[model samples]
Target: MNNDEIKAALTSKSRSAKLERRGKIISFLCIALIVIAVFAIFAFVAVRGIATFVGTKVTLWNFLSKTAWAPGTTDASGVPKLGALPMITGSFGVTLLSALLATPFAIGAAVYMTEISPKWGEKILQPVIDLLVGIPSVVYGFIGLSVVVPFIRNTFGGTGFGILAGTFVLFVMILPTVTSMTISALKAVPRRYREASLALGATRWQTIYKVVLRSATPGILTGIVFGMARAFGEALAVQMVIGNAALMPKNLISPASTLTSVLTSGIGNTVMGSLENNALWTLALLLLLMSLAFNLLVRWIGNKGAMK
Candidate 1:
């Protein structure tokens, strides 16, 4: 109403507007930086990956189909045998086996933590499980090399370093990830769902199986997919136990190699601009693509579950 009051109100309004504009600019700059970084990484990998084929006579079919992967050797006719099917199969075989072994146990533990032993889990078990995630991968590799390898060799026979060893180690590494995610997902389900099931005379077990788990399917699947992704890309522990043999896996107990193992092992052996080096780049590109595909699959599963 007075001139002094009018001036005070005008000053307050001006300060608020300036603060809002500054916040918006900061947020936009953060988002733009993230976009630039992601695109830069993709461009770098793409150029290096495609450069492998430049001036080389290898076909995509030969690279993917032939099982022999002798990057440093030539045939009797002096042609390099760059077939990658063995490594591809080894990667998928170990990853899938580890996932199969881990999923049911992870889900069951998640259910018990969230539904059955909420009090103890909240106070003790959950923190202990979360702590497992921070332990270095090399520590797990050491334990497997010392303890599991000898056990497998004594029990089953053969050099203990094989697919079975790799699977068991990866299974342990992925458990914490799957269990934490599943617990969070199960906990996200509305409490009313359980109450309504109980009102209908359903037992606690039936309510969990039919109502809680059904509603939390998306989260559970997302956790499993994430664990699989980690297993797929794992290099150190698997490489330590998998024997590093660049051949098709004959059986679960046979020595084998995965894509990551080959890359780490072969990178130092090849010259910078040689075909072998380029082929390794191609394998790196394939790994990146596989990770992207897993992410897309997770999004699709989540959207489908949300719709239901």
Candidate 2:
């Protein structure tokens, strides 16, 4: 090659190498920042959570076993009781029930959107669902209070501010997340899979039910996990309807408090350095742990699905 051509080629190579190095540095910096942020949050929460026990001398077993969570009240000995079993069960019950109620509707809506009505889904339904996601939690709470609470009270004959009210509110709140994610997952399934199934004499319904859904199972599960996480972490909307009673959930209609509700209601009222305050920190720590566990479970399920 001529000298000019050689110089041109060398300059281009130099520029490309610099660009590549810059991209790698940017990517590494982004990843490092994320790792540091996660570790920092965990450490901060952990120290505070442990301080509740270390500073107050309250046994972890007592925190777990006691059913009453009367942080404001004390017994004859003047020591506050900080049992969390009731709140723990309440959180689990509402989260699980909401997930159960939301999952089927989410999956069915996703299927219809992706497979049955793609045109209308793209033009109308998707935008509406997206709008639902942007609506504030407090708005949901207000709606539940005005509409769902009265309906439940009139129909079921309880106070209506209970687990059932919370469940209904959460069901609506989580629907958009689960439905949108599931639709994306279903859409990700290759068109050729459906074509092949139909070519093999499988009916349309059979192909969607067996071939498409099976292939999208992992993604659908990931969406469900996400929805459940949102449900678990929700505080304001649920707190508005659930009566915020720190008691074990007796039935669907019973007034109960989840961990988030208890934290939101009690944290502002407790004095710092008190056992009550520290116990609330412990509850925060438990919530963080639950979120981490759900994340790990999602990763595992995703990996397993990818392997299959």
Candidate 3:
């Protein structure tokens, strides 16, 4: 090669290498910043949450087990009644009920899309599901307030705002997410698996239930866990429909409250650094930990799926 061409080639290589190094540095910085932010948040929440116990005299046992939640009032022992059992029960009740209600529908719709009618599922249902997911949470809450609350009040005979209403709202809110994930999972199944099942004299129903659904169990469970996490974390919508009553649920239609709802409603009213405010922070910390647990569960499920 001539000297001029060789010089140009060397310069080009040097510039490319410099650009690559800069890109790597930028990517690393972005990742490092994300990790640092996450840990900072965790630490901040932990400190604030622990302050409820450390800064005050509230014992962990009283906070967790007692049912009275009158955070502003003190009991005979001079400790504020800050029991979270009712909210905890309400949160779990709504999450589990909504998930149970949504799962069968989601699985059926997913199966229909993937196995029964691909064209319609793709062209029509997919967009509808996408639209449902795009709708704001407040809108869902409003609709629940206007429609579901009235229906429950008429049918079941109460204020209509309670765990049942919250469950119905969350069912609709989470259905699209679970259905879409199930569709993806089913689609991820190898076509050869289906053919193999069919060749073994399995009927379509058998192949689907015994093969496809079985193979997609991990992904389906992951989707359900994600839905449950969303349901558990939901605040504004749930607060609007859950009656904001900090009492243990007596029945599906009875007035109740969840942790997220109480936090949303009460956090604004309490002064910062007070027992009430710190208690709310403790709930926030619980939510953060639960979110982490959900993520860990998803990772575990993914690993198990991979091993299979």
Q: Which is the leading candidate under TM-score?
A: 3
- Best-fitting candidate, scored by lDDT: 3
Is 1 or 3 the stronger prediction by lDDT? 3
- Indicate the worst ten consecutive residues by lDDT in candidate 2: 71-80
Q: What digit string (tens of lDDT, one per residue) describes model 3 on residues 203-226?
A: 999999999999999999999999
Candidate 1 residue spans exceeding 4 A from truth:
1-13, 76-79
Model 2: per-residue Cα lDDT over 49-78, one tens digit each: 888678453678978888877876766765
Q: What is the C-alpha RMSD of each candidate to the true structure, in Å?
A: 2.8, 3.3, 2.3
Which tens-of-lDDT digit does each residue in 122-148 have in candidate 1? 777778787889889999989999988
Residue pairs with clashing backbones, model 3: none
lDDT of 2: 0.89
Would you list the rank order by TM-score, best first?
3, 1, 2
Which candidate do you rate higher for lDDT, 2 or 3? 3
Clashes of each: 0, 0, 0
lDDT value for model 3: 0.94
TM-score of candidate 3 to 2 decimals: 0.95
Error of 2 at 302 (Å): 0.6
